[model samples]
Target: MKKKLLASLITAMMSPVIYAQPLPPVEVIGTPDEINQQRLSKETVQSNVSATSDVVEILTESPSVSVNQAGSISGFPVIRGLADVRLDVQLNGMPLLSSCPNHMNTPLSYVSPSQVDSIEVYPSITPVSVGGDSIGGSILVKSDKPFFAPTAEQVTQGEIGAYYRSNGNAKGGNVEVTTANDKISLTYKGNMAQSENMDAASDFKTFTTTTNASSGTYFTSGTEGTTTDKDEIAGTAYESINHSLGIAYKGDDSLFQATFSKQSAPYEQYPNQRMDMTDNDSNKLNLSFDKSMNWGKFNIQAYAEQVDHEMAFMDYKTSKQMPMDTESETKGLKASALIPLSASSELTVGTEIQLFKLDDYWVASPAPLPHMMQPNTFWNINNGTRDRYALFAEWEKELNPQWKTRLGARYEMVNMDADDVHGYNLDYFPTSGSGGAGNQTTDAVAFNNAKHAKTDHNLNLTALANYKDSDTFDIEMGLARQVRSPDLYERYTWSTWPMAAIMNNVVGDGNGYVGDINLNPETAYTVSANFDWHAANQKDWGLQVMPYFTHIEDYIDAVVERDFNDDFKVLRYANQSARIYGVDIAANRKLAENNYGDWSMKAKVNYARGTNLETDDNLYNVMPLNATITLMQAINRWSNAVELILVKEKDEVSEVRNEVKTPAYSLVNVRTSYSWNKLRIDLGVDNLFNHAYDLPTGGAYTGEGNTMSINGIPLMAVPGAGRSVYLGFNMKF
Candidate 1:
């Protein structure tokens, strides 16, 4: 089917040129305000395309950005000390949601690194115009845009790339093609990647089989057969493919564009969580129109998305595989206008509306003798819906030659509701007791009897100022008030049973979670400052330091609901006060320039801490102090670089969740790339020392064994990958 679709697209090109010259790169023009935010360099983005499949990894080079490792393709982005739903993440200016309960399919997972054209991060002091329904900062990602020929003559251009990695024997390839005239263009992109289970730098487990030690029972690992080796990370393997088609039209004063995309993944294993993703398929359509008016600029955008997701025991967790399925739909529309109020000032206003619906259910397990195995279907989240409507306005003014200021405000109305839910049975299988079945029935009764509808009126405000102190120094400060409403799962999940609760966890912690309908929206007040020091020429050396603090009211935190006296526990979401503070430093300098090449050095450091003010317990999954430094040499069309990564020991942890602690560690990596007129080749080696270390934010490892039982697995943090050598090549026509 994939091949047939690509062939059809190619045939529809109307016999265009097959190997025409590559078109000149497009130049982006933005307002001066855009320069205030930090952006990733194009070189840096292109260089890492062959090293990782996750687009979120590219943002780690920016200050105050971290990743909560999950599946290879679905790493959660963390800003400051918060992650997941707390951050407002956008792809191609559209906000997307993870349809799965475990978040196996994230927004970034849909777009490959090779498709990214530009990325920007607003670590803390986010502008109100760009922030909505989120307390943390914002991340913006844009895909490569369609290109049109400069002349009336038709033009055809494309690029094909392939890569291979030694670790896990990973391999993938990508292809992109564009055909265009002066006024219209059509483009297509497709990519697929797959890998075997990766191994840790050293053996971390004692046993090879995942069979339950206490019960002396074993099950096959999916259809693949057998158990994992001592050094293998059982559930780290994955396979995925993505395809997109775009069309664009340019008029004298207006432009219209549309994109259709699809994604399919047979499996994406998650070692940190108990369950693995068996299938995830999605389809999306996006449309936009932009016009240049005499008074201002006007734009409108509309998008729709649908996802079908399934989860079950895969890889090593093979005992009594339970099938869970989810279906979600999203639709959104936005319109904005930028008007110049004066020569030195501009007014920007926009309004947006989004509607989402979801349904999650689990089928009855195969007839079995196990006490917990049921004979009926389970309703997890039936007919769930969340809708948001928002309006925002911002004003930017050049107060004077040396200072500029911006003020903005936004209002959002969020409504959420879900139908009743129930478990597979009302009583224990063999005997009637106060166990899993009884608790499930009781929780279902209570949830059904109570109201499931909720509404929140949220407001956000921002005030910012920038001062150009001198030719070599400048400073910027800002204050912001942000608000975020809970997601459907946080407000509608209706079960306390350990097994059911564990399935709803999105943080990858080896724990179960229950939701509360009474939970309140989070409101935060933040203050931040940035100091920039640079050489007079702004090329030889540069340094940027940012510090920020936030106080949050009604923060969504968990409280122990059921303690099993073990590593895993069941918790209920509740509203509480919390605080977070962090600092980020980034610097770069020209080390030397000789016949060898122009040498340069760059470094980034980040440190953040979060505390539950009510209980004084540390926040879960807060990254430890870390830094990355790189040395680069460039000569002609050849580029080479070496990187060092350092991380501190994690001692502060969430007492309620029994979060694991990791020891300090460091690693080295090297890469070199050479380019010809129309082709490029890259070679790189990661974890050059093959060092053994635990990932501070990797959560608990439950890749295999009796994952169904809450306490069946041992307590341990996931280990980092071993050394890997990769080779890649790309050709353009």
Candidate 2:
């Protein structure tokens, strides 16, 4: 999605005095040629963020991005062609440490969308200062920064707002009270939100196409079945409670802040997912401090977060499952510094470490095992941990006033370990549903000893050249080398899908499953060029176009066995060559701003194609051609904006059989806002036409051809949220 406004101040961005603080080596923020996403002129996360009206709504405007889900409220965000854990997620500059055993806790779940101050995404060419074992991209979700009181005004502040939705009787409210002085600052904020999603829409495409031979389900247009928004099960998702508090301090030379948050769900269910959870209690805490100096600045941060996810997963076939489970304890630490040696050169160095572990206590009561199968006798446990560390540095040199260059590199290493893995027996159970949660039978077989450990060496580099003129246009071009390490799940998590896709019948059995300890990282070589144009004091029109291409030498992926009739075949992680190419164009302009209501329009178009060199086919999940257009008329306090979005159906396939192709569709939305003094209200209409459709899931698994899943395995589709409304109120005092 293209934003309607650009960095319009060509003179301000190009002026020799870009910084008023005497040039103590300012972090590059105002340079339009630097690829900065916002106009904050500071490195503070708040300045780079784009406050998304809603989480899913955010992806509609982003290029080369998509989302998928089995329900309306929760889904996975796909960046580039990678989804799930392949993307790097940061909260307050620290990692959240993902441990989603069943992909239950998506990255977005770590923070509430309404509470986000900014969300800056760095596509394929991620900055080493943030990206880790990420393949698709990196996203930083920053909490709102403290709103300082004007030096000439009182040191008091407050804000309050409420939002309501139609479909699920959704309602949320927020209030903030703050006070700040010359040296100290503080803000306390709270919110209450809940939603009943029995009104969500169902995906029709999934109902018509299937690989099942025994079941005959047809497709018909209109409200043929249930037109309700959500699925048949009302409890698939439950109401939630959210609360948070924060404290901060700032002086002429130093800054410090801390935040505490809590979120809970009373009950949750998903027909598509075998396991159900009664509760997910999460507690999060973040703290960081930065010191500014004359020649350079140094930053440091420490964080700790824990999630006690208690869930009960069930197996339909055997009438057995894991109930009341717990996955607890995740922690980490990080620190960085920047130093300037001369008038035109600066150096940045940083390091980070994190450890994530899981403890699953499962018990099964299979109905077929015996007559009076004990309720909890069968017990099994799985304990695993992953440790990661990295060292990085980036340097910038000003070859001349109108030219500059940047170079960066990083070295990283990661290791994983698992114990007591032989806790279940599969000889008597062929599915995750057959035995209790403790009955993952494949574990008792001849397990690979090296599955518990892995080692990886990752490196990165970036070089750029820029041109700028106070009265003319500016452009920037760069070549970067970024590599993502294999996630722990891609390595040690054994037979991870049988429990999730057995009923589908098209899934592979873990009969011959072992991880490749010698797998290499997915490395990419990317080249990009972006240009920005401004018309001085004219109508203020700007356009930016960036085209990039990436080539991967050893892309790690799980390939299927060609000839295997055992239902499921040998599954191993292997390396392959892949190439991706795409172009992104976005423009914003004030068409005719004479006096007939300042007219402006914005548009963005992006397309990408990837191929697996080894298979001679399209990459598994490349994003299709997509675009968003918005037109608006502005008059003082009232401005109306209308948007039309188009997403071409993607039918490309690089995998075998070429069976999985998503359909095409379009969406429209309208937004209007009014402002008065320190108060403002905005309203928006999403999917104004209420169109129903299917979006690509940017993920692929081995199956028996394109016939769909044989056993009706519950696969989630990124269904578009149909016909919705949003109202936002902002107040400052």
Off by over 4 Å in 1: 1-32, 210-223, 316-320, 369-373, 426-438
Per-residue error at 545 for model 2, in Å?
Answer: 1.8
lDDT of 2 at 632: 73
Clash totals in order: 0, 19
TM accuracy, model 1: 0.93
- For model 2, the local distance difference test gives 0.56
Task: At residue 249, give the lDDT of candidate 2.
Answer: 77
Write one digit per residue (lDDT tens) for candidate 2, span 448-553: 3334466677777767667775555777776777777665545554443333222211111212333444667788887766666656632356666767787887
- Residues 1-733 of candidate 1: C-alpha lDDT, one tens digit per residue: 9999989644533343332333212111111355347777565677788898888888887877899999988999999998888988888878898888898888888988888888888776568777588888888888876798997689999999999988888999999999999899999999999888888899999977644323434222333445578888877888999999999999999899999999999998888988889899999999999999999999999999999999987742434557899999999998999999999999999999999999998877764424444767677888999999999999999989788999999999999998877778742222223335638667777787788899899999988888889988878888989999999889888788888888899998889999899899999999988888877766678888889999999999999999999999999999999999989888888877665556788888999999999999999999999999988876656667899999999999998989999999999999988777889899999999999999999999988777777898898998999999999988999
Q: In model 1, which range of ten residues has the least summed lDDT? A: 23-32
Clashes of 2: 19
